[model samples]
Every structure is written in C-alpha cells, then in structure tokens.
Target: MDKALRGKFGKLLARYRVTKGKGFRLADHDPADTAGLDYSKAEARELLARGTALLAEEQSKLYAQDQWSVLLLLQAMDAAGKDGTIKHVMSGVNPQGCDVFSFKAPHAEELDHDFLWRHVRRLPARGHIGIHNRSWYEEVLVVRVHKEILARQKLPDAVRGKRLFDRRLEDIAAFERYLANQGTAIVKVFLHISRKEQKKRFLERIDHPEKNWKFSSRDVAERGYWEDYMQAYETAIRATAAPHAPWYVVPADNKWFTRLVVAGALLATMGSLDLAFPTLPAEEKAKLAEARAKLVAEKD
Candidate 1:
C-alpha cells in the first residue's frame, strides 16, 4: 500500500477536540505510535530534510501574503531532545522570519502579571514563525508539579485549591482560541523520553567536555520529581488539547526518530493550512517578464 498521507495542518488542527466538527481520533495519541510508517534511517533523514524545505516554502508563501503565523510550542522534561528537534526540523527556514524563545525562571515583572503575560510579548509577527523552547505551559508543568511555585500566582483563598489550576486551563483555552481566531497556527509537542533515556543523555552531557556546559545540578533536582512531572504533563495534555491547538506526544528515546517525527508532524500541520503564494496582477506579470528578458539579454 502507498504511504498514507498525514493530510494538512488545518485538518489536524480541526481534529483537536475543541474544533467545531472535531472528533476523538486526535486525542490519546501514543508517543510510540509511528502510524505504520516504514523507512530506513537514511530515508527518514531525507524525508525530514524534505519536510523542512516544504515547511519553509509554505511559510514563505504565508510571509509574502502576510496571512498567518505559526507558534510551535515544545514542552518536555530536561534531556527530552527539544533543542535537537528544533535545530533539525526548523533548519531549512529563513532565520529572519523565525524566532525562538527559552522561557526560564520569571523576573519581577513577569510575576506581577498573569502567567501568559511574558508569552504575549513574544508572539510571532504576521507571516513569521515563533518557536518556544519552553512555553507558558510551565505554569501548568513546573508550577503544578511544585505547589510552592503556585504561591507566585497569588491566587485568592477560595480559588487556591485545584479550582485555581482548573482556571489556568480555562485561561489557556481562551488564549489559544483567541490566537486561532486571529489566524495563529498553534502546535504543541511533548517529547516523551523515559527516565533511563534521560539519565543516559545526562551522563553524556557530563562525560563530554563540550557538552559539560549543559550539565546542571538543577537537572538532578528536576529528575527527582519525575513522577510529579509526569502527572503534570498528563494533566496538562489532557486539559489543554483543543482542536484549534493540539498536542503531539513525540517519543524522544531515539533522537533521530524524534527529529523525524517532529519534522513529519510539522509538515503535516503546515500542509493542513492550505496556504499558497498570492498571484501577481497582469501588469506586474508583464513587468516581470520584461525584466527577465532584459536580464537574459545581459547574460554572459
């Protein structure tokens, strides 16, 4: 049988539960699920490279038309290959039109506003792509995992319990809905790497001189809270997955496979958008033909 088409970004986004006609197939996506795809490592790499080019092409059209935006939100535990995925899958895009942000510990100003405040400032400009290495979802992940961090939100007494957390979910839904209504394509991917895999990757960072800079004591502390973090991810994925903005739990046990999956999912999403380059007017087409004729006349 021919390889199945993953279809377009609009289709996949519509598959999210919150979309008007969305169904259940989009939810409960298994990280290990490969959708019966069969290709060698070489083939997968080539496909990934092609996917990047295709994404860039569509993005270029979107940019020229000044039509839409894509905000790719990557969430994962440390060593889950978020950086690797971004570097490889987005490599073909023009850097000028793409922006990446790493959301770290918040400052005083960030604390003063709502959890999504900092992210609003970093939204992608029209016709550009924004890649968030770690997004506002940390409010759900880190804060939910560590209640002490929740104190920073300064919730009211009655809303201080799980209700407060549910409210954040509602806020996220509203925020994403607003983005979709404003023509933003939201892609949230979770790199699911096992504890053993994370440990191995962490060891590599420690043993390699060049990679040593990536090692931190904080990673150890974070791993210690593995169970809590897993629960946090499960809860966040279950709650925030809307049809307008869906989450894909990409398996990160194999870095190359993870990169391929990220690229494949990206191509699937961008393709779903049904984008195209704007057509030129008749006078402009004639002007371009005349210019090309002049260029050919002057050719060496």
Candidate 2:
C-alpha cells in the first residue's frame, strides 16, 4: 500500500475501531481479500504518521468520557508479527492508560490459581485500554492441544474428562460477559498470516542484523504446529464471540493492512459505548466561568 493509501487505511481503521460494532463480526477478516492491496513504502509511512495522531485524539475522547474501556486481545502463532502490530498500531496511545500484558509459561503462583485467575487480575480499569499479547484462550489452545497440561491444573478426578474443555469455554464466556456488564468492550483479533509469510518473517529475523535477536529455535518448533494452532484459533473465535466482546479475524499477511484492521477494531469497540464527558451542573458551570474570569483578570 502506498503512503497516502496507507494513511487513508490507518485513518479509516482508527475510525472503525472507535465507531465499529454496527457491522463488526469476528469472521469478517479474510486473508484472501487483503492480498491484492498495492501500496508503496512512501505511502505507508504517511498513513502510519497520520493514523498515529488520530489515535491520540480518539483516546483523548475515550478518556474524557471515562465511561468505558477498550480491550484488545491479539492471538496468533509465533513469527506472526505480534510485536510489529503492537509497535505500529498502538504507538499513538497514552502510556498511562494503555496496558499491554504478554502471557508466557505459567509461573509457580500462576499454576496454583485457576487459568482465568491471572488474566482477571489484569483486566483494564475504566477509561483505559488493555491489550493481551496472548490470553486466557491459551488455556484452550495450549491445554486442549496438549492435554497433559491439564493434569497440572489439579482438578477433581470426577470432572476429569473432555467436559473440562467445555467448562473452560463457559468460564471464558461468563468472564467476558461480566466484564461487559462492568463497562468493558472487548475486541479479539486473530492475525491470519500464511505459512509462507511466516517463513519470510522468520528469515527476516535471521538475515536482518537488527532482527537477529528476535529469532529463536523454539519459534521454528512452534511453526511446525501451525496447522494445529490454526484449528485451535478457529474453535476459540467461534466459541468466545459474544455480543459485548467479538473477535475480528484480521488478514495480517500485509503489515499495513494488519495495523489498519487492528486499529479499526479498537476504535469500533470503544466508539460503541456512547462515550461522553459527564454533564456539568449549571451551578458548577457558572462557578467555572467566574473562576476563569478571575484568572484572566489576575493575568492582566
């Protein structure tokens, strides 16, 4: 995508993120549809710059309203450009109000609690934005695919069958609904990059001097399970999608498009809350006018 179009795309996505939900669906992101967009590097640079500014403006409005929170859950396989998406799409947000949590292997304390326990503790406060690098969905994806992990959870032997999977899903849905009721709007993005794209990015990590630090042997190991992860992602998206918190399958083969879709999803989710500043009482408004007049007179 060219710089101008990239700006257009970014700006549009920002608008979509704040004002979305009218026609949003988790399955609407189709990789096939995104492959053909052609834009130059110069164009992308311009879009990225403007998109960044617009994001700040949108965030200001969201904060001033202080009525809701926007949660972005990004789930993808290794070598799937999660870092790049975070860098570009979220660069414009306020640092104080935006929280990005990356979940890795469970620690001793994490293992002691229920799977949802750690994640629930990190839920974004009102008027804030929370981005989960990998999330509670990991319980289903990593555990279901590798059942042995469940043995560590130490649930009772009676409820130890495949029904455990169903229980996890229910917990996720119920948790999300409770968040919604408490004034959070969530948008989940599944970055859909082809295996070919994955290989290319992996090579970039190896071949590029600056990116060499990013490559790991385990990345290749996880790459081997790409198909399994895809199926897991598909199932999770279908199961956890709810009216308050829906997922968007973003075509992430192109970094620019990926940023746009993710940004759009964020703006859309936040915009849905009918956000506005609290109305000033008439007496307070008059007092504020008098205060300002006094300040102006003192300055004179």
Compared with the true structure, what per-residue lDDT tens digits does model 2 show for residues 184-279?
Answer: 888877777788888888899899999999889888887777777777766666677666777666777778777766765665555556666678
Collision count for each candidate, in order: 6, 21
lDDT per residue as tens, model 1, 99-119: 999989898888888789899
Cα lDDT, model 1, residue 240: 76
Residue 148, model 2, lDDT: 80
Quote the positional error of residue 264 for candidate 2 in Å.
1.0
| Model 2: worst 10 consecutive residues (lDDT sum) | 14-23
Best by lDDT: 1
Per-model CA lDDT versus the true structure: 0.77, 0.74
Structural similarity to truth (TM-score) of each candidate = 0.85, 0.86
